[model samples]
Target: MLSKIRKNLRAFSFPLWIVAASFIGTIFLVWGKGSVSGPSGNEVATVNGEGITLTEFNREYQNTVTSLKKKLGDNFRKFVKEDDIKKITLNRLITRKLLLQLAEEEGLKVSDWAVAKYIEEIPAFQENGKFSLELYKKFLESRRMTPQTFEDMVREDLLIQKVLTAVNRAPSVSQFEIKELYRKVFGKRNFKYKLFLSKDFKPQVSQKEIEEFYKNNREIFKKGERESYYVLKFPKTKEGEERARKAYKLAKEGKFKELMEMKPQPLKDKELIEKVKEKGFSFRSQENGLELAFKLKEEQYKSLNEVRGEIERALREQKALEMAKKEAETFKGELNEETGKVDVSELVKKLKLLPTTNPEELLNAKVGKKLILPVEGGFAVLVPTTEPEVNEFEEDKLKRLKEFVLNVKRDSDYQNLLNLLRQKATIKVNQSLFRSVQ
Candidate 1:
């Protein structure tokens, strides 16, 4: 219950710090920066005249990495490229700076009293439904934040909210539109269908067609370029790196392992092969840094015979899909117009309708009509059994629907506002400085 309240408070553009002995109550405080320094040192970007320092950029970058790591697990770094992450993080920082600049220009101010009130209202910061000064101090200490620093962050967040709220007005919805929407969404749909598996109609692809496909898409058969290196693992410490560098220097003399008090291990052929197949894995080991002296190998493409099977499979799927469409066309005239129905159980495999497979197309279908739509590994032929009927509405559902629509409008407006500010602001980004962010 306390967590629920804490989450709600955090959504109000204010950070609430709560102190417990364990790592239970936590607050994600938005860090605020001072006035931008001149373009002399490592400034990754500048919004208007305010420069984003390397220190600030690194902090945000690390925070982004942590969040992504949590969300994607081990695949975070694997799927997302370093340069891509840097670009996204830099854009976000610039957008934030632009928003803050706009807030100041619009004369939006947040008082210390408001900030204090917001903090006190957080259930996590309260004891017996009242604010606790001791808990506040402990929380600040735990986060290594001074009271003034926390207050300044809260002030900036509130100012940004003020600017956003000023332009974000709730959209009005009419009764007729609401009723129509409710009918479209909550209406009962009864559809009977016959699913056709693509694999069942696998067309025999000729050898000549396979050759053509392989010729046109030659890059698919080409192997990824690889680098083979004997990695000498060492602990990440000052002494360890020094020793590893000495070993690297001795590599020229062919006494690399002898000098380093180690045996030369053979480069794992199987491991290198696996790395070539999987694009996600990085073979370079940064800890020892000995992999730098190794040789790089050019990639070799597979022979035509090696990739013939793959091309044949792709061709078969293409032909099968075309055949499925033709098969669906044949069933079109089977419908009896006067009765508005046909018993297709004997002719085709009958199945129930599922929302996952083209719900919109199936729901809005005309009676006694056939819709041949693509499904996973197959095609489905749908026939609506009955006309769509509106379900009874509830007051709570109507209220929620209105709020959802209004929120969508406000979100769109916010994005447009950001784009306008980005175009108008004198923003400059130094690509070289991005490399220095640790």
Candidate 2:
């Protein structure tokens, strides 16, 4: 869990889109004559003349990498192109710069102390439910962060959150809409579902059905190839990191105080921290560093490499379990006898899987793979169903469908707004810089 939460960011994170706001304008960037100049010549643009320096850009880019590593996991660095991450990061920064500038224009002022307080409140930097000076110091030491740098991140997070909250001031749905949503989302139906295993139909499936299904649902069938993944993680809450750094410092300074007096951080999980310590894993003042945990001959603490093999084994076992569940109610259908042995067209229509010209009965399909088979059960290969057959669109379902359509329209409108922002802003990217990074 610590590994997962620390610095993880995936492709699904904030997309490069502009949010609609009655508010407009960028924040006035506070950089003197010696402002950080962005790598690109075109540094000052929309907001209060904030210069995007190479240093600042690099910082953002590194942050992007850190976040992606957190989300996609440690392996993300190997799989994701650094250039791609930079472009995405740069665009996001610019959009944010514009939004923040607008927020400034609207007279939104966040205090430095507020930022500090917010940072103090973060649970990750806490130990024993209180903000620890040791925790803060350790984080700065390990990640090479200064109090100012940490404060800036907190401020920016709060600033963006404030801006977004303001934009969505009237967060609401109508009573009728809420009722309809509740019914559609939470309501359970008693309608019986019949299984039509595609394997049974596979015997009679023809080339025509195969070709047609392939033509229609080919996109779904095509899978993106996997890439090598690389990940680097910053230890959780600086506790583990602090433990390492303190020992390293002591080793260098020759300060040996096992019962070192240190206060915990605000909002930290004290109970959990105590539990970890109770497990014969007390922080050794100047011991063998992280080696203390890994070097133990007993099973209490396994080396990271040792733990990974077990993790992989567990994953494989989980996959086996899922495959078993999917095969139990499987069905297959086909059109061997044309006239009416089974109405080839009707069977295809009922099953909803697009029929291919030729069908192969796949007994086992891994979760990642999509398969079309006609077995003795019931389902036959046909066009993937968008909605139930003409006879099957139930009463409440129609209403739900209408709402879904509206939501799609709203999403489309949001995208259009983002495109407009992109146009209005002067965004210049240092592609060469990014290319090298990638």
Candidate 3:
């Protein structure tokens, strides 16, 4: 009977499903106060008396904040409101706590060496394919993370994850489920489009809406958010020579470094050297010796104003992302926020991304020149240029837009599902650990 019970439990375990969702749903949290007094001495939250530590929570919290900011940047606070961050953090921590508790109930386990080995392989802390002590120290200093703290966090994370894997074994998903999952996950149609340009859509816009849109976003469409005039080479714009001369003079004078310091760097990034270098490495004008010079963090661009186009472009790209999201909503054929369900095949058919070919090109498909893609909450178009546009954002933008909108609805849906399941769960939490959180 014991063997039968174990076998039956195995039947219910769906390791693939759990593992797929495990890291995909990476933790997002805020710093929790206190530390683990000893290895697993106290629990932050528990399910059936299991311990989740403050240290683990803090580590994940920092990562969550870092990951979110990387993704949303200036807008992270806007989308992930303070209350939402805390709520998500608490919920994430609690869920992990419960999962670990379940793992313990089943006696799932991992070795310290497994975690140690994994740590050694992390590229961020590595130098030339090996862990570098210097890189490790610099990283911790930059994030205010310490070695002991980082190790405990990684260990707990690995142990919990390993335990979850043990509890949820393979072959539990079953062939029937896999077949169904296959369609749900991969059922998509490709779109082929003959772009209806802005002009085409322009006439359809109501006078009132157009005027209203213009009024609210007049600033958005303003030419040259950067006040600098373009240098129209061959017959450049007025002041074009002056602008070029100014940049050339700055480079010649070797004052590029001083000039760089005078410009505004984002307040949040001032303390972050690597991140600042990342932002400033790319320049506006064509590459020359100046590009090589700026490669040294101590070296700067020709002049701040000379690279005003870069600044303006960066800022414009930021605004465009938000605008793209807003426009995706209400786009026809979209998985609207309301329904949250899309017959993706239908979309593929509509978008003409289906496998069917256009015979006119004779064994070659006539790739649409310009096509506006409507996402769950944004609209985007790909316009082919003579040259590849800087930061094509071709793949990343579409993926992000989908994650932004589809996930909005998907998140709520999943949470509601969890709520229903939680009612049936026998779980407990360490209230003292979280009650004082800001």
C-alpha RMSD values across all candidates: 13.1, 21.9, 19.3
- Residue-by-residue lDDT tens digits, candidate 3, 223-275: 33221111112114446445545554554565455444434232232333344
Q: Model 2: what TM-score?
A: 0.42
- Candidate 2 Cα RMSD (Å): 21.9
Task: Count clashes in each candidate, considering only residues at least 3 apart in sequence or on different chains.
Answer: 0, 71, 14
Ranking 2 against 3 by TM-score, winner: 2
From the highest TM-score down, the ranking of the candidates is 1, 2, 3
Q: Is candidate 1 or candidate 2 better by lDDT?
A: 1
Local error of candidate 3 at 186, Å?
11
lDDT of 3 at 31: 26
Q: Each candidate's lDDT (Cα)?
A: 0.61, 0.44, 0.45
Rank by lDDT, highest first. Answer: 1, 3, 2
- Number of the top candidate by TM-score? 1
Task: Write candidate 1's Cα lDDT for 64-180 as tens digits.
Answer: 687679878968888888876776567667766776787677555677788889778867789998999988899899877799877776676666665555445423568777766
Candidate 2 residue runs with Cα over 4 Å from true position: 1-49, 181-420
lDDT of 1 at 346: 18
Model 3 residue 203 lDDT?
20
| lDDT, residue 286, model 3 | 38
